[model samples]
Target: MNAESPNIGAPQRPVIRQLSEDAANRIAAGEVVERPASAVKELVENALDAGAQRVDVTYADGGKTLIRVADDGCGMTAADLPLALSRHATSKIDGSDLLNIHSFGFRGEALPSLGAVGRLVISSRAEGFEGAQIAVTGGAIAAVRPAALNRGTVVELRDLFHATPARLKFLRTDRAEAQAIADVMRRLAMAAPYVSFTLRDVSGGEAREIFRTDAEQGELFGALAGRLARVLGRDFADNALPIDAEREGLHLTGFAALPTYSRGAAIEQFLFVNTRPVRDKLLIGALRAAYMDVLSRDRHPAAVLYLACAPELVDVNVHPAKAEVRFRDPALARGLIVSALRHALAGAGHRASTTVAGETLGAMRPEGPRVYQMDRPSGGAIRSAYAWQAPIFAEAPAPFAAAPEPAPEAVNYPLGAARAQLHENWIVAQTADGMVIVDQHAAHERLVYERLKRQMAESGVAAQALLIPEIVELSPADAAR
Candidate 1:
């Protein structure tokens, strides 16, 4: 150590201490409950894990003031209340096996984290046990007391981030936060088609329903289709094609809209891994790759895809919020996504979306009824018209010259035989059942490009030499120059 160093008088030893329970929970809240939407997501997932058939969510002032989630699921008893608020304690999985996680939440930090930053109240009633309620404020827990409740569990959070006032400044406007909450609800609803969901805004003491969907019945695909129609709109359900494909041990199933029904943005894309919604880069990239040849760069494909495999094959603990995941064989998953979507698209042939027909009809509709007036011509006008028809009607126009007719075989061929050329660029051909119009230049260019690509792919565009060389005659002086 140099004597001139300012650290010469500083203590040589450093001390480390454990964080208090309340402080530790508050820190966890910073990760698990970043904002109002985070709280909504955690609570909803818990409800779903409880085997709730229906979930209802209500929020006030973008969840900063209040947020409530109620579900008719198996409620926890009085003894389970305190344990539920303990960090790293969860009923979803055993500590021995972390690889095979089936539930939406397994970290067991959501309840405690919320309690550390806000006033949390949970009221529930089990089937055999009486009703019970527990309250926690700023990481301080109160004793469970008897309360009035029918069945299921109800979690209410009030004054979120009140304990940590500095976090309030990072939140967005009330409307934006509410929109985030709605997005979360939509994703969750799509994942579980059998469950009914409802969302309401309870601001200003007046409750207004923001979204609602009843439980769908029937088989898996049918129920999922009905739920999708209710959530993504009927137009998408009408235009989208059912996708079902399996590779190795992984299976991919869902609906992908036709290329003609693509979106301007990727807002409609939803991906799930074992019923857990995720925004993974590999899956999204593979989806884009599958549609690369059919859609332009500016257009994005719309789809709702679910990839299912053994739970042991994937790791969901990659992120604190469990929004991202890792697969044992990422390449296999990507290939499955790309191949399945491409096959579905190819199976659709050249068919356009049905929604396009509706849009076309709307565009062709008349603005209003049109009126036509008819008047009688006078005798002088009729006489002048007859005078202009003089000269034997111009010798009957030379018997109306006509071109030769095309053969039956030619007409039956695809794209038909060229009947006439218009403006030296368009070909008007007669098909078996209709007339075909082709752009001569554009069609020729595409054909040539495809042929070149095939040739390159087959044998590196095979070199060719001219059999007969052409000679150009020129003056000696010009050739030298």
Candidate 2:
């Protein structure tokens, strides 16, 4: 037994081994650099951390061929260029404090992660210093050298994931990836209205500017509305209600749309913490709850909310990509959003959006001459030519009529008194200023839907078993609230 199998009971040698720097960085890149949009996010965040006032992004072939991000921030010198490419070399924070993170690119993982999977070239120039450049390819470091540049930094990455073809295979179509990149740019632009941003497409032989925003730093929310109008469209501004509310040291400020202006999807909702864009579950749920009463169940309200609080109140290092966040007091943040949004909406009143109002006016103008009717109470009133005389008969005492009912004060009411039901469904209501045309069918449908929802909420939904047993599966980890 000893000669043939080398003794089965013999202890095996330790198989543990340390990974090379390249392999370690590549592994980290898989998490940090998921796609081209991720690369754009990390690089732009680094630029912003450098105090860049203007950032420019150019991409080709959906960033699979080439991607460039240039910023006019304080750049690095020849001595610092090489260190900037080194792993864990960060200027944002020291090793002491993890909770106090003001800048976006705190962890030194993004740069190395990018260099590990792509051909990266960083050219930078510090103030009153010579310009320099450094290159990294597939995690292989190159020597720092002098480069031709006046000021700031420009980072270019070509042939992303070329060394790792499998990563390239997982990328989406060029159009989809390009749209994702645009979304990232727009979100960042909205967050930093003071800083200018430009995006270019250099795919079809020549470079063309896709989107651009100039630096317009002013008072808080200054030019923010203009920027939002440009990004979300002019109609959004016409329909949006300004929100400025604070509670429990958390200040919330942004634009929330009217309930009637709700969209078919929740894509327009944007949430930020201390000017940092995020998509957290607590924030999203609170937004939904705020619009629960005003908006229909099938529709979604659009808004862009920014919250400013102490850095310690929020943990931005929840993930390597830094897209999600963990609030120290999650309940405080949720309550702040719900309270702020509801207050803003209440102040906005029960009015429709500009688009809806215009459409209603246009539709009514095409109809025939407007007909007027007598205002009568709905006390078992029948639709007859003697409809006007029935009210007098109801108040009669003996042979003559008793005291007639006092007329209602129409000025205090919103829709005034209902006059008649024209065309069977349309209710002609007289107002102090003008008459309001209400579609009874549509109004009744919404009322019924809301009533059903209230009943379900109070009693809970009843479940009925199917004739055949059904199968369902759930993940081990709990879903977001």
Candidate 3:
């Protein structure tokens, strides 16, 4: 040891311990559920997975203030209530099985995350047992207690992000949050048409009948169409065309609008896989390819398409939110959408009518008119007519009265002429420098959606002008959020 400076040991380092259950839950929640809408999504999925026939969601102050989701699903027993809020405790999946996920949620993170961040109260009752309630606030759990409730689950969340005030600043206005909540409800409702869904805005006193479907419906399409009519308005149902086709073990089914009914944006394209709503690029590309020939570059079509196949063919776990997916065979999925919609449209007998001078013309006629006639000149025919015509009309004799020439026919310029049908379904068009392989269905869908959006924006949405307005019923707690 030097006398000038006493021998000193290395600086002491603090040992790190594994996060506690409550801390771990808050961390997990940061990834799975962010805002109130995320909480709503997880709860709604849980309800659906629990075999709920009807679900009701209510919100206030853009979900920053409050959110509640009640489901008439298989209610939880008293024993299950405590386990429901425990981290990593989920009825959806087993820890051994991470590869195959059939349900919308399986991480077992939602309940814990929600409880960690907000004032969470979960009340439920199975058929045999009395109702039980559990409350958790800021990662602190209160003991479970007996409660009175119907045979269902009601989850109430209040003061979202109160424990984490930093997240509170990220929320939007109440109206915007309400709109986002409505959008989520619409997507979920579209996915599960057989389930009744109701959404209420407690802050504004605005109640929307989001969805109502009879479980006895023969097939999903009918119920889905009814639900879409409720969310997207009845005009969409009338304008949409049915789509059903199969390729490479994948089945595509849904409805797409005609090119004439396009919208100004791609917002109307509702895509689902195995009854789970998603926004896959391949599917959107395929839809675009379907209407490439009939629509302009600026427009999009309106469509609601469902794809079904083996779960292994598509990976739904690509995102935490699961709004997007990855396909084992991207080309095959794109091809299926393009071919299905193209074939369906063709079979429906919808031919693009020619437009000229603001008027739609019927199909072309080979012998309709002779704009230029070619004939062998008779004896003195050409010379004599030309020789006499110039002298008689020296100053053009006041322009000749002739019908205006018909406007040029609009031609289908294959995007790049690199038009190759991939997988016997998709039409790949080459661009000027880059290649633009389109999904015929998604392209047409974009076009149709664009036109409709433009028309709506200019003249306001064409409401059905209801003879008798449909009245919506709501629950008291739901009404109060």
Better of 1 and 3 by lDDT: 1
Query: On residues 1-481, what C-alpha lDDT tens digit does candidate 3 reach at each position?
Result: 4465433667567898987887787777788877778888999999999889989888877788789999988899878977888877888778675657788887677888998989999999888889999999998989989999888899999998888888877877776777677778878877887888878767667655433444436676777677766667665676678787888899988888767667799978989998888878888888999889878989998899999988779888777778888889998998889888888777755432111201211111123454544556676877656765775636544334568999987544545453454532345665556676655445554556776899888996666767888874442223335
Looking at model 2, which ten-residue stretch has the lowest summed lDDT?
Answer: 472-481
Candidate numbers sorted by lDDT from highest down: 1, 2, 3
**lDDT score at residue 129, model 3, on the 0-100 scale:** 84
lDDT (CA) for every model shown?
0.86, 0.82, 0.76
Task: Rate residue 144 of model 1 by lDDT.
Answer: 93
Alpha-carbon runs more than 4 Å astray in model 2: 1-14, 367-481
Instruction: Note each model's CA RMSD in angstroms.
Output: 17.0, 14.3, 13.7
TM-score for predicted model 1 compared with the true structure: 0.76
| lDDT (Cα, tens digit) per residue for candidate 2, span 1-481 | 3376655677788799999999999999998999999999999988898889999999999899899999999988899877877788899999698989898888899888889999999999989999989999999989988898868999999999987889988999987888888889889988888889999989988987777778775676767887787677777887898988888788999999988778889988999898889988889999999999977888999999999999888899988888799988899889988988888877766566765554443433324565556555455646433554665747444444469899955353565566665534356777788898886535555555776898799986567989899863221111100
